[model samples]
Target: MWGYMRPIKKAVFPVAGLGTRFLPATKVVPKELLAIIDRPLLQYAVDEAIEAGIEQFIFVTGRGKGAIEDYFDMAFELETTQIGRGKDISALHGTRMQPGQAVFLRQQEPLGLGHAIWCARHIVGDEPFAVLLPDEFMYGSPGCLAQMVAAYERLGGNLLCTLEIPIDQTSSYGVVDPGERHGAVVEIKGLVEKPAPGTAPSNLILPGRYILQPEIMQVLGRQEKGAGGEIQLTDAMAALIGSQPFNGLTFAGQRFDCGSKAGFIEANLALALDREDIGDHILAYAADLIATIQKGRGLSRDVA
Candidate 1:
């Protein structure tokens, strides 16, 4: 750990993933641009970072992701059209970035999360920085990053957005070896990425939001390919166990793995159903749809 800590002012977004799960839709549009109700998945993550006091954004982008860059730039024509229609463009306010606030870099290879984060090392410099994965959609107040930043301030070390998953699901995440806990904060002694069934140390796992020391970028620099022949961020983080202050914060929020189609649909439905403007409407529609499906199943049984 540094003798004096620097407040996290920068955040890195690793958006280089191929998003293979979304397929043909992702072929032309980045899955990050896919709207949740109305706001794109990427917008939510950026908003979360901003709420956490982030001043600069480092987006580690991949090939064919220019649309993301364009999205943040001034949309002159759109602004003019909205003005002409006398529409309040307040919804578009948070999407604007000040000069030098955002820097996008290319991840030349399809390496793992570790490598993608490593790509932003230069922009991140030597301060503590945040990493937000847009694919992991977080819902609720204070946001995921804001909660982690608060925990990091109290603990003064690296902190991850942690969750206690079912034992069978341990293989799908970076499982943590628990050491202690206070409220939503958990002290972690070890981390294992995607452990096999029955081999994980604990069900608690990292869930794509992090406040990491700059030293981790160096750890990632030397990290070899782990589980999937790609540099795993968990590998570098696990190496920091004994050398630095580390803990996990079980964030207060609902999370969705928007990388998957099911999760994407679920996020939209959940958010829509919670909206004051549309909640009751959607609830009735959903109930009616379920009734229709059940009645159709009953008709099929009668025919059989």
Candidate 2:
């Protein structure tokens, strides 16, 4: 099966959106650069791609996002300073990407996710590629993209990382209409982006990781604005349903939506709590904080 299909070597990262959610902080820094403990969200996504055997990273970027390009480039001054101080520089090794591995293209306008992806069509050419949104962090041992790649190798077609969420939350995500199921992989009968409340076909929702065929770019090329007056990627994806094989690979890990403020703080705490060096300390602190809040609430109840 692997030999019959074109291997996925390139990944498209749609990072062009203005991080309006983070506001003043994002005014100076790209939201993708926001740190979850120490590493930026973009780096996590890139690392996942690397782990999934991606060779080329195509970044679809917008204005004020130059820092993302610099992030993958060699840090000469910093490296020289670390070397002069006799400090360990091994940590910096993973920050720099290999030469010719990264290519950044401008989106030029604040269109939408679909348009952002179409911006990289020339680079992606006529091959299957992965799309990982930096804002959605998947915490797993094998990583989300690696899991999807493994599935792609077995069942070669468009694959989306899916997870079952509460039915009430379906309105906030692109829900999938399920058909047949094979273990963790579910056949996608249909897709509805942010379906109206109480009208979603299923509770399973897309979590921003995708392995799509290059034909999606052609569908996007002729797509008109649908939702929010922006070119909706879901709409374009829906167009390729019957003509191509579309399935959902249920992620076996938790997903953090770092695009919102609450999700960002939650991701920071979650990852910090997972670290061996600080997990216990963070757990103790969190316990103490909860105890303090509970004590204060009990006192207020008594007064009332």
For model 2, the superposed segments whose C-alpha errors exceed 4 Å read 1-3, 297-304
lDDT of 1 by residue, 1-304 (tens): 3347678999999988777899888999998999999999999999999999999999999999999999898888999899999999888887889989999999999889999999998888888899999999999898999988887777888888898778998898999998988888888899999999999998898889998899998999995899889999999999999899788888788999898899999999999999999999999999987998888753244553
Which candidate has the top score in lDDT? 2
Worst 10 residues of 2 by lDDT: 295-304
Among residues 3 or more apart in sequence or in different chains, the pairs in candidate 2 whose N, CA or C atoms overlap within 3 Å are none
Task: Report every candidate's CA lDDT.
Answer: 0.90, 0.91
